[model samples]
Target: MPTPSEDGNASATAPTATKCDSEHTPQPQSVCEPDHRRSVVQNVVLIASVTLCMIVNTANLTGVSISLPTIGRDLHIVEDKLQWIMNAYSLSSGCLLLFFGRLADLYGRKRLFLCGCAWLGVFALGCGFAQNEITLDILRGIQGLGAAAAIPACLGILAHTFPPSTIRSIAFSTFAAGAPVGGALGNAVGGVLTQSTEKSWRSAFWFLAGMAAVCCVGGAFSIDKDEPYQLDDRRVDWLGAFLGTSGLILIVFALSDGSVAPDGWKTGYVIAILIIGVLIFALFVVWERYLERVQNGSGTRRRRWWTPPPLMNVSIWGRANGKLGVMLIIAFLQWCGFLSFSFWITLYYQNYAGLSPILTMVRLLPMNVTGFLCNVVVALVVGRVDLVILIVIGTTFTAVANLLFAVIDPAAPYWAFGFPATILAVFGADFVFAAGTLFVAKVCLPHEQSVGGALFNTLTQVGAAFGTAISTIVFNAGLTKASRKYGVEVHGSVANAPRPAQLVAYKDAMWAGFAFPLCGAILALLFLRGVGVVGHKTGPKVVDSDATTNEKTVSHPWPTLLLVYQAVEDR
Candidate 1:
């Protein structure tokens, strides 16, 4: 019932209303108490906690590769069954991201974040004691569900705590930095833990469990409980969530299990499941649309929208800038490039270069450092640059890196082919990740940010899952062909195989890995076109706006809620 006062401040029980661009000026009479210092500390803690979760989540994705030989040997895991270790986590985490994002908005970000940490820690501990591959795989899936819950909420919380353009840009930069940082750290930790004589690979799980426990304790104590608005207390779109989750599960299941299935791609079950997933996803969209319409009818103010309403906003999607849509596409494409390297590069280092897991991890440090630098620099420069041009340049460099990798051979020198490609790819990926994330942060109003961020991350994981699934198929098929043509025994350790045979299979698999980033480059380029047209910026040079729409749309002011926003304009 409260509205903005003459001076653009809100009294008790009312929300402050101001244009988003006017955030620099302090406005009194605001309902919410401002605590920039505590908010920053809490945000930092949130990052560390989420980074811990991400480390385990992504490490488990690739760590299984390093330990596959040992696991298979010790547990008698068959060739086909070993994949469940990775697939279980991918399917569970990727599918449930949107669900958790909405839950954070409905209940509380800190609450769900703590819950996810508990779930992840417990499941990680369970993995340490798992008796069989099947049990471990199931536990991995549970861990992924917890990660799915925590990650999006972490991002949403960051979105809320740092609503100002400059701070939001920095927060997103930190968030994006976590990916490459976590990825590199995961490999390093997995390598060290796997090398331990006392515990072997199980040590990795225990270490992760311990890390999650620390984060849980820190997060529970550090994060602030104050929120700008009251919980909407609306019903969760259970049917929509069900359909969407089932659809993704079916799709990923088809992708992951298809190659191992008896009939391969032609298998009836695979086809049926994929078809079902697609159909259900379509239904979910329609259901969400109906829900949106119903909510719009029930509320006069768009700010009073349903709790965690449909992940996508049609208004934003239809806008000329289409920043949200571009972000979705970038999430799909950028991750495609990143995940391809995550899945395939390890194989290249192992089979072709004959490096130990530890050696590979060390060799990858430069790229990770480069990525971190790029992330930091891009975050600093985001407010000054044109987004579309920045994305174009970065993605183009990524494509070039992928192309270089496609043609790499055993005789290729590390400095010439590998080093440059590593640098370019790392820089490109880091830049694109930061820019795309900024684009999303730029477009959203605060109330919708949690759900919006959840959607962005969901697509990111989905894309990575798809990219990994497709790349795995290509690598396996290519290896199979090279084995037959070169008369090499492909199964078992490549270390024991003939040099020529191993080299051929490794190079062929590397070549096949190009499919993902190449496709990513093209898709990202397509989406880059519309980035700055609708009152948005569009170039490589960083240019600050003079109190423009870019800042105006960054955050929403609510009179009924206590959210602080822009101050009154002189006009």
Candidate 2:
């Protein structure tokens, strides 16, 4: 935001005043990355590097999921505890995202990204060597901290590396493609490794470790360096950070582990923790609001030295004709359904159908294949088609995927229901991911891209965790009810349960997943009706939110930027 101080007008002071490499001549205070600083090759390599970061983190999550059953059996873990394998990762990553997102914006994205990669790799290796369930879960949770940092940084870099344009949209689509591709590959490769008695499922962690190390090296070499932060929002909101991060950790922990508690949700500890978490979260919001008001000059122009900017930039909601705000809410809802559906699909193939891990992988291959094609389609259509159509249709596909599987008979041929469901799942997930990330790149100011990326991912990742928790709760309840009907006992492990009860449990879980995305689509259809045409909003790096004298709103920038972009887009 303090543009000319670091990157701008030192060159202007020169007597000769030679023209810059950029098409536009250098202005005293404007900021522009010199075109000559990055070659076309550098840009491609940078994209590849950042995209690989997304792939590895996503694959790390999905790949470990397919191995959950295997890990449970080997580690003698119960069915209830097995979900922790996934929840722990999601919890750590989700809780820490906003903190690291802001950090990347202030300190540097490339720096945070590289550090995250190295941390992830080391811990992934630790996970490979873990001897028991507790050790593995602990390692996995720590590994997710790396993901929280790296993902936001990756998105932040993409936002700056390429400005808003059709080409940027395609680049974002490629980046978005990483999630489905990683999920698909994680399953295929995880299955191969899991089915083997030699490498076993632990090898999946090792594989992730190796890839993380590779990506770290590539990113360091490719990502462009950040300018000196001589002037920026360097103040850290220590109290807000503590409240926000700790509150989230407590809430997600309660949601994740509550179902398995001795007395379930009624347990005193669970009730206490949940209540405390909610109250603390409320306080965090109040604190952030107070800081925002002060910073925006509503209360005082000379803010206290202790005060700092809010963890999340509030104006992000108004970007893109207020579509960005709705999109984030939609992100949570759609993604809540996504990973849950994928997780159950794996179990449906292996646990229900009695197929080997490799065979399960084969059954799921169609989804990944479709996901690849869907990525390409989204890239092609995102700029050409109306975004509202793409979002609603894509979200609906995911809901349908869950519904189809919910009613399917395990004895039925794969082609009858499973084939279409898997394919539909990919299309739904990929489309939403590409469109969502592209909007972020276009909507967020250059300085706030990391926080924007973090906000989007915070919803999506936390939604995944919440979805898993809900499915697990519904699943356990269904198993108990159906087991009673079938005159059987459902234990901590489903392996010993009756076939009828297990089948009913899977369907119940799938139904929960179905409801989530359906809600997302309805929300989109209703609120997004007034959304402006999806296009890039280009402007200065930093604009004050609310100006004094009440003449201009300086505290929010997107409101004005939206008008500017809409005017240009209309023409």
Candidate 3:
């Protein structure tokens, strides 16, 4: 095996055996190693290609929202069934993330990435051709599965390829920028397509399909190959995958379907599914813990068919500083606020403001533009500033933005309330997302990078689903109350509600949206303190005389904090 030098370059010659090695058997070397070096242009191409994939994925997420009304109208879809357009994608994507992340590590990042791109392209085209709501929903779910496969591998590839250097930081920043950029483009493109008489909503799906195809071709040529890493004697956790996916799907279904259920939350099917989902989720946690203990235990015992390597490194969460746990919670809450804003704002423009799809996109352009511009600033300042401080600031902005939305009148002028709110909301989200991604990447070990990325995105999707469900519930309740009070004829759907009822329901839902970010800000302030670096020692330490003279130990005051802070700055 080639030995790595101080600069992380692998030497061609193997090290000569010393007298000490002859005296005592040497330890086995690790199977994993970095790939052969590539030129600067190659690295850029790779980064750009992966960033394109990210753009396509995020664009699909937000772009579809703008096209929903058109799609529902064309397919004759009821309001109750409309949620599935987004929920199917979010649910499948969220549930399969960890499974695919682990699979990428066990197989190969490049292989899975290619497969995912192909799957994404195929299904995206399928979605464009879908004849009915059911077909479209199924296709969208499959498309999400493809996205889940690609996302983790993209992150892992970036993490492994770049290392801890300026290039790596730039790569991550560029990657981070894709979300907002794609979202902006998605909105613009969706609106333009929906307005086109010939293609309408289906045009958006065709565009995504073409984008994915280009990315797949570019990725195949650009990304460098690496050997797959697998733990000895361990196998894939099929049982855990089944339980986790099923439970999440059930839970999301319960929450989303409750909005349209005959009896709402108290509906027998909704209540039963919710209970079963909760129980199954509880069982999934217990099963994961059991498998974890087995993996960590001494000696090779007879392994059960259900047992597999743990999906996540439980130790990462259980670390003394608890930064990982805090980050996870922050991601969950922020996404809740972000998605609530994204989904409802479009509805507000359409139903209350009485804007066309193109007009709604035009009005919401400020948020997208702000998000894109702020991400550029984040890319510039990320490493120099403290990550916790960035997070706090971002969440603060998010809370304020949501609060503004909660109080704004339906007739409020664009410049007065809408523009400022848009700017603040997007700015906060971009900063938090960019900083949070770098923090997780810096903290995780090389092998765990894919899973780390998976965890981050899983929480994001699940949080979005949660936000949509909660907002729908609140909005529906408000509509019912307002209708009864004013004696307006009530329907089960928001789209069918009277104008006054829609406005009232939306105001109440906006208040709930405000709470998510506020809670996130409070949590960050209370728990996010001090930088804690894992695996590396901090500060100076005395050297022992008996220790080898060539051995070196580098330390920082708090290594985790410094590394993450530096990582952000370098970006």
Candidate 4:
């Protein structure tokens, strides 16, 4: 065996290597370089494994919707209480995301990711054996906590592993595609499991548990090991975590409970909690700002108790173009539309259209299929096109789809309104999600990438919760009114209600749903019109060469806007 030397020479008698010189010495012949092919294979495995985890988590989010009615009947849960099953998961996940994201960055991403997977599996199994609504909801909330821990860590790993390039863009796009894919699969699989007389709704949870178990074991081997970054004196912001999580949970509780409470929003408890939630959120902002000031003032000196760094970069809020702000708003609105429509439409198909669970899945399958295809298309053109235009087009399609559903006749053929609406909704959702995620990854600084990813997912989960809550309120109110008008008891799923009552409730709720995407469209037009990707040119613009030695001037923003609009129209 030959010994290695510092000067790339193999010598029988090399001078004894000192500690300082050893750092530069090449390894002996027995040591081998990393195999590029093996590393590539590992990267592929890691991507697939992380993507599977995402699919399961996202699937659980929506898969339970189709099973809600069955679960309600079996567990003897009331109409209003059934909403909690879904809300519990979303609210918990949404509230805890920021805290967990920061924790992952401070600790270890792979460790957190594995622990989260384990938590998900355990809770999912608990849900399978749940005997009542309370048990199910509690277990679901824990499952969501697991999702909160895993999702951002997985994203951070991806961002850290893949450098900023087309590869990263494609990877993010592929990961984003999991949202629609899992959602669609969740609907389809949940329907299948719930429809089976032998397995029933419990089988869905078991299925989730199985998938999570697979992810945990696979992730343990596939994910690369990385050490936690050292932060000398910075600490986790426990106070901020408490305030923010509590505030979000309380707000979601108020929203979900508003329609069910005796006095609605006027109920003293509801009103009080709502106020407290808003106040806590306000306090959270104030505390974070104060911490920022303290950190700035300290300048290199460590304090005994200083505010930890914020979950998100405060500067992201002040970007001149406001791209991140626009993206977040758009994400919130899009999920609001998507979740409400998906939930209510499932009810519409099962109750009003008299479709079986399997049949409902069949009806909804087109949207998922279309969504997957559209995601592939978006990933190909994302870098070349203006994302704002894509957003506008997507929101427009979503608005139009909701409007179609609002006016859809109970007796309409599958081809007339249902099919077209599903297609449009899928296209709209896939485009916004895929493009928005890629855009966020591109715009964020390397250090804050995980935070950015967490914020994006937080908006999504929060938006879904808000959408579900608002839709529940509107649907319950409309159901109550229709029941009173028809002199029937308001005691069952809207699907099982009298035809007249069902129609009235669904149409009213659909009208409310239409407003969300419309608002998204308006916001995009107003704020996102001039924003472009960070590194991409904003179309062809006239430049003033002598404006400054270091700066280039461009023509008016109107031409860029026009070009984007034209491009969208042409596409």
> How many collisions per candidate?
5, 7, 6, 0
CA shift at 46, candidate 2, in angstroms?
A: 3.6
The model with the greater lDDT, 3 or 4, is 3
**Candidate 3: segments with Cα more than 4 A from true spot:** 1-44, 160-167, 298-305, 321-323, 384-386, 441-450, 531-568
Per-residue lDDT tens digits for candidate 3, residues 67-99, read 877787789886546667887888788888899
Between candidates 2 and 4, the one scoring higher on TM-score is: 2
Residue 399 local lDDT, model 3: 68
lDDT of 2 by residue, 1-571 (tens): 2122221112222221112222333322112233446677777777787777788887887788888777877899877677778878887888778888667756777899899998889998999888898998898889999998888777656655554455455566567677767877888888888888586987988888888888788887777776424333578788887898678767867876677788878988988898999989888888887876676666445578888887875666766557678889888888889888987887777777878888888888887778888866764566567667888898999999999989998778889899889888866577776677656645554434556667787888888887888888888888878888867766445866888888899999999999998998888888777443344323222222211111111111112222222222322
* Top candidate by lDDT: 2
Positional deviation of residue 410's Cα in model 2 after best superposition, in angstroms = 0.9
Indicate the worst ten consecutive residues by lDDT in candidate 3: 539-548
Query: How do these models rank on lDDT, best leading?
Result: 2, 3, 4, 1
Per-residue lDDT of model 4, residues 1-571, tens digit only? 1232332123423222111123444332111221233366666777777888889887886678888877877898876677788888987888788898778756778889999988988898889899998899888887899998998777656644553345545556566567777888898889999998576888988888888888888788777665665455448889888888888888888988877787777989999998999999888878776665555454554444555776555555433346677788888998888777887888788766778788888888888888888866774576577877888888888877888889998777988999988888866677777667555644443234455567777887888788878887888888888887877767435635678887888887787778887898889888776555322333212111111112222211011121221222223
Candidate 3's error at 163, in angstroms?
5.5
What's the true lDDT of residue 387 in model 2?
Answer: 69
- Model 3 TM-score relative to the real fold: 0.85
Model 2 TM-score (2 dp): 0.85
Looking at model 2, residue 100 earns an lDDT score of: 83
Name model 4 segments beyond 4 Å from true.
1-41, 160-174, 298-304, 313-315, 321-323, 441-447, 489-497, 533-571
